[model samples]
Target: MIDAQTLEAPTENPTIRTSRRWSPGACVWCGGTESVEEYRNEPRCATCRHHESVIEEARRFMGMYGLRPIGGTLQSDDDEEYEHRLGARDSRRVLNEIRLEHQPDPELVRKALRPRAAAVVAEGKPAAKRPSTASSATGSSRTASASAKTAAPVKTGTVDIDEIQTRALALLDQLTAIDAQLSLVADQSGLAARARRSDLEKQKATVLRTLAALEKARLSAASK
Candidate 1:
């Protein structure tokens, strides 16, 4: 009969390492059979790799629907299988872009689109100049040149501190409410044990408040 100890010994977890031996064949994912080789090259079987792909797709779908980039990783929504609506951040970017039509005077963009506009206002003048002529002598010439320099655009791209503070305060309120909800939910039996709603909510409020204070100070000096 097989030894009791041998039978009771645990099978290894693929994600955890406990061996130094090498397998005779290559791993399908990274072509490594040896444990060291697998460790260095991140080898895996086709099934495991496919499972990873599924998880990534799930993450992307969640992110596209405004799930706040998950906890730490910015999910790249490249999977065609899991198409979802734009998140709040993406929606804000689109809205900002739309507002540009109302105030389209960004200096860099205007300069890029109208390369010929950068030419000296007098460039079209004849090669030969009269002895007494000053470049700014004419009224029309001065007006055109001045307008080119000063009137290209006057679009504001400033970040308003007061508005930012307001947003932060709003987020703080949200966090507080979430925290209270979490505390209510944390004590529930079964699956609710793993929930960290209250902790996350409290963390959210703290981080926003700290950032708001720092930004307020920074903008105060900048505005000066």
Candidate 2:
């Protein structure tokens, strides 16, 4: 017989879980007996709901920043592994921001990052990719120069709402990553860290408003 203490027990309201059989087990963390629930791949009781919320928020925060769980910690999807390497202290704070227990002092990452510019075109799916120029070097250069001068500028009014929203979402993801880094380096000692945090805060506010407006516009258009 498996010891109930070793196995995760079911919540008081057994209906909450639909995956497996219900058993009477205690929460590994708080030893609460009321309604233990599963959290962060572990069995948590109702007493740990606050902890569960913190982790849920962290995951959402990570998703906004183009990060995914690599092992037990957060990591970027970039080819270079070092770019988004978060320390243990920083990792814990990220996992739970409310209490901020064991928060690390702010330190700038060696591989600094800047948001990239995303180009969004107006209406009709971005014109299909054109074949590369095959003419002589001099002729090809001259042709490209001529085309550049002749091409009409894309107007703001002509910009596609859906396309702009998509671009904004991508930009928001990058900004979210920057925000996360800023949080790690906030309020410690250096002027650079302070300045970076200030700039990121401003950028975060602007991006959030833009996202909200875009969402409203999308809904309005759909209704019409």
Candidate 3:
């Protein structure tokens, strides 16, 4: 069954998924029209749908590698997002196809599961070879020279190591200043404790005087 649909966000109720009945035909890309492309009860042949899916996967791969598509992807037939999208759609599927003949390394096998082309790009290498750091290093020298030429010349300001050491020593001296403050606080705390005790003694004497006056008044009343 060949039916068009508007794909909703990844997990939203599709606006037009149920637009077609299940049927079979020769897949245009790879002939096997019996399989479903998007999901169960979804329209579109597997091959054609996989084609579109590859594009989305390529975008994901670019995102993973921190390669932001500037403005937008370049439009061309030979563009990576167009050609290898299907092959990179699921490297796992490719591995599974030939996995019986070869058991790959766990890491390599894991890489195989990723979007193939994207992983290659993310690793900072082409599918054909590793990154040639020699060229980059050579360019670095040129870039450095160019940058130096473009930048303002350094003012011959001399740095005095002794001055830096003096500042560091001053910082240590500031930290030690807390020791004197702490000693002062300790002395004040002791004085405050003594003052509190003196106040308590004065209160005790006043209490005793009140008790003696109360007893004298009682004796006077008895006499009356």
Candidate 4:
């Protein structure tokens, strides 16, 4: 016969467990096993703590804007309601993209917040007074008057047809003389002589075109 103390102590496997034990493993999100005590309850890494907090903040922001998603499929006949639902959907999509793509850094998030904060503050500031229409019109009128004063006055006068005709005839005479000189220099063998002839030919062509234009204008003015 065994004694009671010997019988109780002789069992190799105990039927009842006295303490809790957790298996060590990598975090599901960040694949990290460090800081086991910090993430003992949740299966997330320590670095992801800030990231989770940022997601919560984004949710709160959407809530503040009345843009939080509601349960069930959205069915809206009213345009305003539809717009609100659409805005909420877009905001959620953007937030989800940020949560997935970015690792949360405090400085970067703070910098991002600055512009929106500034915009809100600016909205609260008093608006500057706008100039009245009468004053604006007066300013424009003064500008117009100043411009009129500074501008060169246009000469409004009739063309002297006889003078233009006489000038055209003189140009024709000079052009004929130049053409004759050009023909003489064409046979000469130097580069300078060739260039001089080319210049004279250009002058003759210009004179012919100008004389034609002047004669046309003279006839038109006479008819009028």
- lDDT on C-alpha atoms for all candidate structures: 0.36, 0.40, 0.35, 0.43
- Point out where model 4 deviates above 4 Å: 1-157
**Rank ordering of all candidates by TM-score, starting from the highest:** 4, 2, 1, 3
Model 2 per-residue lDDT at 13: 30
C-alpha lDDT of residue 118 in model 3? 52
lDDT of 4 at 113: 43
Question: Deviation in angstroms for 137 in model 2?
Answer: 38
* Per-residue C-alpha lDDT of model 4 across residues 1-224, encoded as one tens digit per residue: 22222223222433311111123343322333444222212334444444444433433332322332332345553454455555545544432322211122324333544565466557774332122322322332234333221122111112336656777789878988987898889889888997998888878887786677667656655665
Clashing pairs in 4: none
Comparing 2 and 4 on TM-score, the stronger one:
4
Better-scoring candidate (lDDT), 1 or 2: 2
Candidate 3 vs. true structure, TM-score: 0.19
Q: Is candidate 3 or candidate 4 better by TM-score?
A: 4
Most accurate candidate by lDDT = 4
Better of 1 and 4 by TM-score: 4
Better of 1 and 4 by lDDT: 4
Kindly give the stretch of ten consecutive residues in candidate 1 with the minimal lDDT sum. Answer: 149-158
lDDT of 3 by residue, 1-224 (tens): 33222122112333322222222332211223446442211223454455434543554433322233312334423345444444443532422221112111224322333464354457685322222222322222234343221122111111223333444455455445544444445445577756755664555454454344334433433444
Q: What is the TM-score of each candidate against the true structure?
A: 0.26, 0.28, 0.19, 0.31
Rank candidates, lDDT, best first. 4, 2, 1, 3
Query: Which one wins by TM-score: 1 or 3?
Result: 1
Badly placed stretches (over 4 Å) of model 3 are: 1-33, 37-41, 70-224
